[model samples]
Target: MQSNIKPVAYYLPQYHPIPENDYWWGKGFTEWTNVTKAKPLFKGHYQPRYPADLGYYDLRVPEVREEQATMAKENGVYGFCYYHYWFGDGKQLLEKPFNEVVESGKPDFPFMLCWANQTWKGVWFGDFQNQVLAKQEYPGIDDYTNHFSSLLPAFKDNRYIKIDGKPVFQVYQPLDLPDSKVFARVFNDLAKDNGFPGIYLLACNVPIYWEPEPNGFHGVISYLFHSFRFREKNTVFKEGSFLGKVEWKWNNFLEGKAIERRKKPKVYKYEKVVTKISKWPKMNFDYYPMVVPDWDNSPRAGNSSMILHGSTPDKWKIHFHNAVNYINNTSPADKFIFIKSWNEWAEGNYLEPDQRWGTAYLKAMKSCL
Candidate 1:
């Protein structure tokens, strides 16, 4: 493994049943519900991705969490950035796994948190219009204070991931925050007041055009893969007939409407997408690159999924190596490559062993490291 570069994979803590999940999706609802029911939308489309080595395990089991940590450690992953969701007014979902990790202190793994500060919507299940499960609200200073206070335990934990003596906390949607600058100032001050060195606040690169500014964040983690939409209009019949033009226009109109209906998932060439990202212009600030092994969210979003086809272990290795090389040459002193995920089976983007490509993606990551 590379000594300088820190490889932190995003960990989704939705394997266990939660009250909200039970209410929103029936009893015993978890990510596996969507993952297991997914079907291929087109030819050669990968679907119903199933776990292999780990099997269909529940996160409530202590041994399951331990095994995950062990596998991550063995595959050259430095740590996990657990997706931390804090709906306004202190309401949180999927807190069982990380909570257990914090309280038990078992596995002795390095970790951090990325606040997935977004409102819960039913867009995934084709209810884009009427379902608002949990709305995100930033009720100003008091809420921010409480939020920081709540995270104090994890920030002070010995196993927390840190950079330059400061515990790392990432914001999934920094721009969504009412006032990001205030958040950074308040959180940083809280860190110092709590007797810690400081906080390394990272802003996720969501908007794609976002630049590193005085937004209270120390750096930006380039999560660009999710933003790329590579599907082009099918124009093969554009010049042949008037009927073709009308049909094309109707199809385009339908697709535009589908944005709201959450229909028609966009598919793209994985190799082309990776190559395009590798050639993207360099950022001016402390920027960390990211990589996705393979992405097919048909499980979660159904036809509304964004699928990246033809993503083999070989292709992943190329993408991973390019990210490593980019960070090494551009910002050698600040080495961080955030993989999109460790195990997000619903999205089909994970390093965990799966039935089709058992440990192949993990091996590719290790090769790059």
Candidate 2:
């Protein structure tokens, strides 16, 4: 294992069927429904990327989790940061896989939870608003405590990823989190009470300029997807300032008028987005750099998808190399480099072996490690 450089990949837990999805989508529906139906919109676009070794296994199967952990560990991935969904209070979606991992203790792989605190919409079936499936609601102090209480089992698990004896808890939409400081304080207090030093709170989907500590977060992991990476089309520069040293982050997406209002998929070369985005103006001490293996959400968004024209294993090697170096130079506490995902088949951004490239992407990352 690389002690100084930890590569943690985001793991999506939407593979197995859930009652919520069955009702919202269709009977016996999972992410595979979207993946198998994706059709190429352009000539060279890769569509219907099929899994090689893992097949379309259900997450409810313990053997599948074991195999995923084995693959991840063999390729130098330090841990799997599962996308944990908490609609508020003790309500959650996609909790089965990780819950089993915690209770069964079979894989024995390191992991952490990232609260996907967002409402479930009908976007899956193409209806954005009218069909409200699961709306996020933050009740009050009691609910917050119960939320922490529910996670106590996973937090106490020996396999839970931690820093300085503190379990790392991530919030996917920290910007949407009401009273982040309070949330941090409450979670930290709860952790201390549970024999932990404190909870290492990390925030995601925030601007590059966003500071973590001030906002009660230990650090930030900006999901620099090629689609939303603040650059040329929306970037602004100070008069006579250095070229790469100027412009904004995704705050424009959050603050300014919406940009994803396109009728067609927005496509860009992977080389361009990775090359330009990796040229950091300056190393951010409070920020952990992220690398994306590939991206194409057409499987989910149809024509409105944001697609990266070409992303091969060869390109991933260079991108991964840059991110490893970037993380290596950061403070030891911030030495973690995040991969966009281990498996998000619907989004076309996953490191898991696919028929298109097999384990080539993982092999490329192995070279870096």
Best by the TM-score measure: 2
Give one digit per residue, the lDDT tens place, for model 2 in 175-269.
67778888888899999999999999888876555677877888777545532543546656542345423344343334212323557877989
- Residue pairs clashing in model 2 are none
Where does candidate 2 stray beyond 4 Å?
128-130, 226-232, 235-261, 280-285, 332-334
lDDT of every model, 2 decimals? 0.81, 0.80
Q: Write the per-residue lDDT of candidate 1 for residues 1-369, one digit (tens) a residue.
A: 778878899999999998888888899998899888989899899887879999998999999999999999998999999999999789888888998899899778999999999777786543555467888899888899899998988988999988777898999878678889888888989899998777888888444445546777777887555445421344344332676545544653454345566558778899998887665447677788888888888887777778889999999999999988888888622587888899888888899999898988888889888
Candidate 1, position 369, lDDT: 83
Error of 2 at 149 (Å): 0.7
How far off is model 2, as Cα RMSD? Answer: 3.6
